[model samples]
Target: MNSPVVRLRGLTRSFEQGGVRIDVLRGVDLDINRGEIVALLGPSGSGKSTLLQAVGLLEGGFGGNIAISGTDAETLDASGRTELRRNHMGFVYQFHHLLPDFNAIENVVLPQLVAGRARATAEDRAAELLTALGLAQRLDHRPSQLSGGEQQRVAVARALANRPELVLADEPTGNLDEATSDRVFAEFLSLVRGEGSAALVATHNERLAARMDRVVRLHEGRLQHQGKADA
Candidate 1:
């Protein structure tokens, strides 16, 4: 059997605010298998988003170990961590952060272009991904021109553009309406699973969280196995 694509051991984080130390994550131990989708479910201030950032390498000041694809992030220097993040990780947020000036395909291809792929090659791959996501007709549309669901779909395509091993999403459908949110969530799950990539999503929607293979809840600065039952 294959090892987990992501592993966290004794993960802890704290922040200082107004001369007070606030413990966010106590000691989290987690394992995310490749091609699996896990939902981090919690209420306000439960440390769901914070844990996502720690695993995604977006924030430091965290003690303990985070291994991605078997690479120990705790031992890596700044540059090493940056390299690993850029090449192996992806992220999506509640809002679609698409550039207003760029078309759909261009926005999707931005990461590949940033990684130094030739513009033509990147554009070609972006077009292919957009088409696969049923966005071929909107390829030249700006974010404003597309519906909310459409824009989020483009964001999903962009996340997969780099063929990343892990994608971290924080409340990805939090801002959408109920029907549209469900549709967007389904698209995200399908896209990640279709590519055999692992995803960790932090969401408040119990119905959506229940559909995932596993559900983890963050409460009182610690994690618990709420399982699909809570959802």
Candidate 2:
């Protein structure tokens, strides 16, 4: 009965370049329980992004297990993997990656529409999330018209559009200034918590990571639990 939102075991990944193998992940095991947020701490090029990519099923060519909501990723074919990725999780990146042509609310509503939600229903959901993130007044603004923080806020809102069980954010605020970063991160935590979604957020900022429920560091392609966030 303790089924987690995400599970990884004995996960290993390596790349071959110039007839030499470079290992990125080495037998990593992790579980993200429902409604829990875990911070992944590591230096640049330390395989943090690679680790996220593995959990994300963004690509293949790895070994070991990845189970999302009890379904094994290895057992799923390409279409199945796409279905699983779309239905169960959402991803946020350092860059907003918003559609230049779409407005704030439209960006959020598009994903929901892809998931079979009705246009009106999706729009309502989008407005709710944007309002919660303090973007009620900017609903019609394009990404270019918005500030960096506001654009990231729209990205966050879009990531959460599906009410996914797992939200994967890779240094979501890394592109912002110190003050803007703090503000956006705070809003992100609040929105995710309010939605009752578990999150694996990758960030190098100890101060920001400490705000999560737990923290884990990556070293030598392995995961080391660093205890609870408050610890």
Candidate 3:
């Protein structure tokens, strides 16, 4: 088997409230391999998002080790971490945070542009991805002009725009209705798998979680009760 795209060991996070310590994550060890899609399931306040944040390199104040694509995040400074994320990580949230000003294609194109790709090339890639996601006709539509599902689809396209090695999503379908969520999720899974990027997606829906390659539950500040998908 290939090495993990994401590895965490002894990962822990805490916060102080009223001179009392609240432990969110306590020593979480996980490995997500290349092209694997792992589902994270937990109740609200279970620290699922905290774990994703740590692996995504979105914040500091975390204790223990986080390694992404073989590089120990602890060894990188703030700027270095930012560079690592830019080159190797993609993120999707419950909300489609698309820039209302830009059209679907442009929202997707912006990331590649920031990565220094030529404007023409970036636009081409964006169109290709959006088209594959069934958004070819909607490419010119702005976020407000599209339906909720369409907006989320555009967000999915944007997340994969950089073709990052790992995709970290915190309830990417949470805000959508069931039917829309299912459709969008199927599209998201197909696109991510087609790109061969490992993904760690957090969701509360058991049916969706079961569809993934594996499922893990967060309980008492640790990952527990891991289960594999049906063959």
Write down the lDDT of every candidate, Cα atoms only.
0.89, 0.94, 0.92
> Which of the predicted structures, 1 or 3, would earn the higher TM-score when compared with the native?
3
TM-score of 3: 0.97
Q: Which should have the higher TM-score, number 1 or number 2?
A: 2
TM, every model: 0.95, 0.98, 0.97
Is 1 or 3 the stronger prediction by lDDT? 3
Error of 3 at 202 (Å): 0.7
lDDT score of model 3?
Answer: 0.92
Q: What are the per-residue Cα lDDT tens digits for candidate 1 across 83-159?
A: 88889888899998999999999998899988778999999989988888789899999999999989988888898
Estimate the TM-score for candidate 2. 0.98
Mind giving the per-residue lDDT tens digits that candidate 3 earns over 13-120? 999999999999988999999999999999988998989999999999999999999999989999999999989999999999999999999999999999899999
Off by over 4 Å in 3: 229-231
Q: Tens digit of lDDT per residue, candidate 2, span 1-231? A: 969988999999999999999998999999999999999999998888998898889999889999998999989999999898899889999999999999999999999999999999999999999999999999999998999999999999999999999999999999999999999999999999999999999999999999999999999999999876558
Clashes of each: 0, 0, 0
RMSD of 1: 1.5
Candidate 2 overall lDDT versus native:
0.94
List candidate 2 stretches off by more than 4 Å.
Answer: none
Looking at model 2, report the run of 10 residues with the lowest lDDT sum. Answer: 222-231
